[model samples]
Target: MTSPPPHVAVSNYKGGVGKTSLAQGLTVAAAEAGDRVLVIDMDAQGNLTRRLRAPLSPNPDERFGASLADVLQRPAKGEIERILVPCGYGGIYSERISVAPTHFDLELLARTAGQAASERRLLRALAGVTDDFDLVVIDTPPRLFCHLIDIAWTASDVILMPCEGEYEAVEAARRVKERVLEDRHTLNPDLEIAGMVVSRYRSNLTLHKQRAKEMEKIVGAEGICPTRLPELVAFKNMSEKALPIVECGSEGRHMASLYRDVYKWSRDRINTVMKGAA
Candidate 1:
């Protein structure tokens, strides 16, 4: 079996903090750079799957007929590759991105995940099929201290934290950081915390500013991303239309440029972390 590419988990264990958005943005960055990227939706809400409008033909060679649930729960070793549907957006990156979808029923896997062997399910699933991609981006769920998140993190080489500038968001990120520490001591000693990204930030709000500062302390000033994404209608519009900022024409292109450095920086961190482990 071929070894999988570096799997970066875009997560913060906080809901509504733009984790999926960041995952999509990362995929866009990979695709724009002409890299074959695989996006796996680990959230039971399946927001990422629905946003991508999966089951569409990615290419004429293979068809997607399974879900993320099938990849983990089913005994089939080939399940992972079978579920790689194309993401909805088919612009210039049409051939560059693939998605493994999920739905609400994915919640059913929680019990299975609680089992002792479940922690390595994602890794087992990916062992046979990840050579086709340059990188793997897993959109983790908001729920924390659970088997699902445990399995995802254990499978990842790096964890990319994305949070909102809010009290709950900061608290949740701290919880995740603590869990990651436990991970380093136990399940995945090589797992690295890439950095923290604060999204939906409002510069005018004192609470937002304070929370951002608190997050900076959590990841260190240099560990915090400088591109604080504000609450913008454009982001909402792009998400509703299921389009990555890079595909929305001039305005989208301009907005995506703001994230260019951030994405590259995160990617660099991911690579560095992976290489160090190697």
Candidate 2:
């Protein structure tokens, strides 16, 4: 008698805060922990999709059959299950993770997402796949006005926001929280913004600490995660190979440990939220 796992979303209104990296790292690490994780790529850029090695790349020679766009517009029984494909990239636990991928076609959903009940489309589509995985992680678009973010927000039980150590990035998190709080009230009452995960942090720098304090103002002392991911040149290079930091051998070990700490924090947050629901 296994209960359905909760859906989690990774998002930020600002771009280039290592949002995709954080998403990829968490998903793979979750699978490494022996949990079956489903990662939904709601971003049109499809960076997570590429990292997971799911088909339907940005430019493919042959057209792939279905994507998140098709499912959102016309959700049917088992449609999400049919759309989900294995993540063949992660060394041993790769098959434990699955992906409901996105592409440029997803941009069409953003323009027309204002239709009645449109925000609930993702929630409706995911209903039939409750027994498929132990947890679901969604990678949302970074733009403020994009409906992909709305779709993920509506469907998620908890969301993780990532921000770089900068004024603009921290401000973006504040603005996004203000907007999504409205969405939660109107759309899904159970959804919550778990906390903010500070990415690309430079502890040796003074200004970065100031930026972190500014973020604390937005999410509060408890709302900010304790473990922060540091900026690494290898992280940039790992993106090319689509490897999670933890599995990249020696060079990635440092950042990998930081990511594991964040993972534990997220797991605790999710548990607390779910227990409250119970």
Candidate 3:
């Protein structure tokens, strides 16, 4: 029997949003909850990798080694173990999270390969090590680049599209949904959207709550996450510290609790999806 796919991609077409933070939150939450999680930093900006403090090569052209770009170039023959680096902040309760680090040079991989090949590279690279992690969370680039397309096609078992509380963000989610549908029909038949998460919610702003309600109407209530991560200083602080909110004490406790809510919701969604498929 074949093993189950171990990938989930967090993507959004809009920039300056919380795509990276959501990905980091999920990875950290899953790991702390006793699941071995792996994060693939697919964005060329390297924000996720840098936040996690994973090592990267100074040389960009190295082949089939630690970088995600190299692994994608020749995934069938490369060892996944060699590429994952342990990333955890120093603390008594710091959770162990591993990542496949990548560099901005990864953008070149998408440019060189044809559309189909570029879109499938992440899926092929991930196939080599599905069993190693209970979950693999992918952080995709903002635009509809080849790497993002490949992530949509191969690596994603579920697409978690995070939208800010804005009209534009809602529309972008719809576009991403359309792309996902195309991907499901053509590339990964098993792919489904896990849900749409509303991030950076500020109850004080009427526009934020109004847009969020409109988004729910568009995406449906079943796809909405129960917990709305409030705009908090701790989130920014944690990023600066390269640590999950859960790792930081008093200042971050509330944010950590919010993350836990998302974690339970995600776990439930995964179980439901697996059972429904079975």
Per-residue CA lDDT of model 2 for 70-120, tens digit only, reads 788767655777788788675555679888887877888866776898887
lDDT of 3 at 142: 85
Misplaced by over 4 Å in model 3 are: 1-6, 59-64, 90-95, 115-118, 274-278
The list of candidate 2 runs beyond 4 A from truth reads 57-64
Worst 10 residues of 3 by lDDT: 88-97
Model 1 bad stretches (over 4 Å): 1-4, 55-65, 76-78, 247-251, 275-278
Ranking by TM-score: 2, 3, 1
Clash total of candidate 1: 0
Instruction: State the C-alpha lDDT per candidate.
Output: 0.77, 0.81, 0.75
To one decimal, what is the Cα RMSD in angstroms of model 1 from the true structure? 3.8
lDDT for 32 in candidate 3 is 71
**In candidate 1, what are the lDDT values of residues 1-278, reduced to their tens digit?**
65568888888877889898888777877787777888888887777776776753354233223666656875455457867778778875668888888766566677786477677788777776778888889999897777678778877888899889888889999988888886566668888887888888889899898898898878788678788776676667667778778667666776687666677778777666667667
Residue clash pairs of candidate 3: 119-150
Candidates 1 and 3 compared by TM-score, better number: 3
The number of clashing residue pairs in each candidate reads 0, 0, 1
Question: Which residue pairs come into collision in candidate 2?
Answer: none
Q: Which model scores highest in lDDT?
A: 2
* Pairwise lDDT winner, candidates 2 and 3: 2
Model 2 lDDT, full chain set: 0.81
Q: On residues 1-278, what C-alpha lDDT tens digit does candidate 3 reach at each position?
A: 55654477898888767999998888877877877777888888889998888867675455335687777766673355678878755432234577888877777775656554556666666665767567878898887545555654476777787888988888888887787676566667777777777898988999988888877775578778889888888888777788878767775888888887897897677656655655
